[model samples]
Target: MTGAPITADRLASLTTYREVVQQPAVWREAAETLAARSDEVAAFLEPLFALPDLRIVLTGAGTSAFAGEVLAPALARTLRRRVDAVATTDIVSNPREMFAEDVPTLLVSFARSGDSPESVAATQLAASCLTSVHQLVITCNPEGQLAREHSGSNSSLVLLMPSATNDRGFAMTSSFTSMLLSAWLALAPDQDPRLAERLAAAAEQVLGRPDELARLTGRPYDRIVYLGSGSLGGLARESALKLLELTAGKVISYYDTPLGFRHGPKAVLKDGTLAVVYLSNDAYTRRYDHDIVEELRAAIGSENVLAVSAQSDDAESWQIDGVSDVDDAVLTLPFVVIAQLLALRFSIALGRTPDNPFPDGEVNRVVQGVTIHPLQP
Candidate 1:
C-alpha cells in the first residue's frame, strides 16, 4: 500500500503520524511566538550574555537532549561563545561533575513536557550547585512543573510554545520541532525575517513526498542507519531514536557521522540495512557525505541507500527543495520531517499504533518510576 493521506480516520488511527505531519505549521507558529516575545527573551538573556567568563549549557533528556545537541554547535559558532550540550539525565545523576560553584552559568533547558522528573531535578540541581545560575526554560507544556516553578523568578525565564505544539501523541513530533525552532530564533544574533517562511515551505515540500518515502520504508529492512556531520550528526541520532521509539525497538537502528561510521561502526551493515545519509551543504563536509553514499551504494547496491540533500544529482535522491539558501543547521527542521514520516509509516506497516506503540507500559509518554534522591551535604 502507498502512503495514506492524513484524513480524519488516519488521525484517529495514528495520532503520532498527524503530529509528525503538522510539525511545519507548528514551527511557523513557534517562530511567530518567539518573534512576538523577542524583546522579553532578549531582556532575560542580554545581561547574561554580557557577563564575563559565562558558561552556557543546553540541556534536556531523551529527544529533548538531542535538541541541545542539534543547536549547540551552531549557536556556539554564531555567538562566539563556549556552549555545551548536556543531558538532564547527566545532571540528575552527577550534578557535581557537570556544574561548578564559581562559574556563572546559563542552563537552557528544552522539555516537551516540563513534568519529567529529570527536567525539574536538573533545574533545581543547577540552581543549588552553581553560585550564580540563570535558566531559560523552553517547553511545550505551559502548566508543566518546569514552567510553573520557574516563571516570575528573577533568575529564570520560561518561554511557552504554541498550544498546538504540546503534542498529545506518544512520541514528541510537533513539540520537538517547535522547541528546536524557538531555540534557533532565540540564539541567532541577526535573525532572518524570512526563515520561518522558508522552513514552512521546505517542510511542506517534504510532507508532500510521503508516497516516495512510504515505498522506501515498505522494503523488508530490519536495520536503519542515519549519518550526518556537525549539527546534522545530532539530528541523525534523533532520527534513529524516532524509528526505535515508534517501532517499540522492533527495528534495530544506528547513527553516526559519515566519516565516523567507517571506524568499526560499519560492521553493522548487512543485506537488510538501509542507510539514510543527510548530505551537508558545505562543500567540504558534503564530500565526506558523498563518499559514504557512493561507498555504501557500491557495497550494498544503490537501492538500499538513500541520500537526503538540498542539492542532488540523482533523481532517486530525497531532495529538500526550496531550502538551498538556508543554513545547514536551519535545514535540519525539514530534514527531520523525512525521518518522522518514515518512522510513522514503518510503525503502521508493522501493525502497531503510532500514537502509543508500547501497549504493555514498558515505555511511557512521560517516563515514570524514578525516585529522586537528595544530594548529601
Candidate 2:
C-alpha cells in the first residue's frame, strides 16, 4: 500500500507539518513587513548607533531565546558593536548582573505570541535597570503583551511579524525564522534588498525535496546531535530543541559548536547515535566545521553522519541550492527549514502527533507557569 502525498494541504491534518511547509511563503511576507517599516526602524536606530559605546542585547525565552543566540554574533559583526544574546529567563532571575554595566543598551526582544511572562518582565527590567535602554520588539502577535504594551512608547519600536507567523501549532515553525529574518533586515547595515527573496527561493527548494531528510527517519538511531560554528552554533542549539519538542523528549538531542563538542560533549555519541553537522559558509569557520564532520563520521560510521550545507564540498551532504555565497547568518534562514522538516518526519515516524506532541499539556505553545517576581529599581 502507498501513502497520501505529503504537502502543506495534505498535511493540514497536522498543523505542525502545514506550518513547516508554509514558512517559505511566510518569509516572503516577512520581508515585505520589514520593507514597509524600514524607515521607522532606521529613524529609531540611527541615534543608538551613533552612541559609540552602545550595547545591543537580544533576549527571549526558550526557542524564542535561541533566535537571539543565532542573531547576536552576526549582528555584532555587521554593526561592529557589543551584541549579546541574553535570555529573558536569565534577565528576570538576575536582572542586576545582566544589566550590570549600565551602558547605553538596545534590547531586541523576539517572541512568537509575545505573551510569555518573561517577555514583558524582561522589558520592564531593562527599562528600570539601565539608565539608557531602548527596545525593539519583534513579535508575531499584534495583540501580545510585548506588542500591545510597547506599541506607543518612545523608547521602543514594535515590529509586528506577518500575522500568519503567529503559529497555531504547539511548536514554533514559521514564527522562529520570520522573527529572525525580520530582525536581521531591520537592524543589519547595508542588507541586500534581495536577500529575503533569495532565502525564500532556497527554502522553497528545500520544501520541494523533503525525501532526503525524510529518508533519515527510517534509520534505527535514537539520539541526534547537531553542531555548527559561530552563528550556525546558535542554529545547532535550535535544531536540537526542535527535535526535542516535536518528539516530546522521547528522542534525545544534543547541540554544540564544532570545537566545543570535542571538549567532552562528544561522549553523547554511542551505538544508537546519529550526528548532523551544519556546515559553515566562512572559509575559516568551514575548516573547523569540516573537522567535526570527519570526527563524527569516524566515531559513528560515515553512514550515520549527515552534513548539511549550501556548498557541495562534502559528497555526503544534503545540498541546498538557489542561494549563492550567502553568509552563515543568511544561510541559517533556509538551512533551518531542513531541521524543521526532519523534526516533523521524525515525529510521525515515532507515532507522535506532529500537531500537539504533548496533548496532555506537558508543555505549551506559549509557556505557562512562570511567575514574574517583582523587582524594585
Candidate 3:
C-alpha cells in the first residue's frame, strides 16, 4: 500500500481525508460557538484589552506557531497595540529574551492537544517572568495540561476548539483553521462580519472539486515554493509545511514572501521546481505578488507556476470563490484548503498514507522528546 496509487476506497478510509473535507462545516460550527459566547469572551478580555500599554504575544508550536504568525498582523492593526507571533519553542529556549519586559502581556497560546511540553512551559515562563501577565489558551483538547491548569485562573482564559478538531490524523488540518477562526473572533470580533460564511463558501468550492485539484497535484514537479505577503506570508509557510509533512519529506518545499524571494531565494528556482504565489487582495501587495508570479512563470514556464488568487485574472491560477475583496486573514481559510488538498493528493501520489506519513514514529502527532529545562530568572 505504501507508494502505490491510492484507490477511492483507501482514500475514504483515511482520517486525513475526512478531516480535510470536514473543515468547512467545522469552521461554521466554530464561528457560531464563538458568536454565542462573544459576550463572555469579551467580558473576560475587555479589562485586559483596556490596559493602555498592553502587549499581546501569540505563541504555539509547529502549525500552531504559524497560526499566531498569520493572526498577529491583522490583530495588531485592529487593536492598535503591539502584537507578536512568537513560537513556544522560542519562548522555552530563550525565556529572558521573550519575556524581558515586565509589561502587562497577554499570551495567546494556540495548541491542538494543549499538551506540548513547550506549550505548557511557555505559559509557565510568562507567569514567572511577567509582573502582569494574562493567558488566553485556544486549544482543541480541553483535558490537556494547558486547559486543566489554566481552567479557573482569573488571569487565564481557555477557549476549547470544537471537539472534532482534536484531529485523529498525524497532521493538523481542521485544528489549525478552527483555532485560527476562534482566535480571530475572540481578538478582533468587529472585523470580517461575514467571515464564516465567506470562508465556508470558498472552502466548499475547493472541496467539491477534488478531481480538478488532483490534476494540479499530478504535475511532475518535485520541489514547491509557496509565496505570499504580510498575513498571507504566514499562510504560505503553513502551506509549504503541509506539503512537506504530508509527503514525508519526499518533496522539498520552501516558503517566502513574494518580495523576499527576489533577494537570494530565487536561486532555488530551476527545472522540476514549481512556485505557488498567493496573490493578495490588497492592491498594493498584490502588485509585488503579481511580479513574482510573472517572474516565476518566465523562469520556470507558466506550466510550472500556480497563482492562488481571489481575482484570478491570469490563466494559471486557483481563484478562491465568493470571498473576494476580503482581508488576507479571511482569505487564508480558503487558501489553506487548497494547500491541504494539494498535500493530500501529493501524499497519495507518492504512495504515502496521508493519515500517518511517519509510521515509524519518527515524527509523532503531538511532537515528543523535548526536555523542558527550568528557566532560571
Instruction: Score every model by TM-score.
Output: 0.96, 0.96, 0.97
Candidate 1 lDDT over residue span 1-377, tens digit each: 23344344664466677677787778888888888998998999999999878889999999999999999988888888889999999999999999954599999999988999999999999988989999999999999999999999999989899888888888888888888888889977887888988889999998777667766877888889999998899899999999999888888999999999999999999988999999887778888988999999998889999899998555667888778766677889899988998888777777777888999999999999988899887
User: Can you list the residue pairs that collide in candidate 1?
Assistant: none
RMSD of each: 2.0, 2.1, 1.6
Residue pairs that clash (backbone atoms under 3 angstroms), model 2: none
* Model 2, global lDDT: 0.87
Give each model's whole-structure lDDT. Answer: 0.87, 0.87, 0.89
Model 1 stretches with alpha carbons more than 4 Å out: 1-12, 313-316
Candidate 1 lDDT (Cα, whole model)?
0.87
Q: After superposition, how far is residue 259 of candidate 2 from its true place, in Å?
A: 1.2
For model 2, residues 1-377, the per-residue Cα lDDT tens digits are: 01223454545678787788788888899898788877888899999999999999999998889989998888888888899999999999999999999899999999999899999999999999999999999999998989999999999999888878899988888999999988888888887788888999989988888677656777766889999899998899999999999988878999999999989998899987879899988888989889988888888898889898888788888888866588787788898988888887777777788788999998988889988888864
Model number with the top lDDT: 3
Off by over 4 Å in 3: 1-7
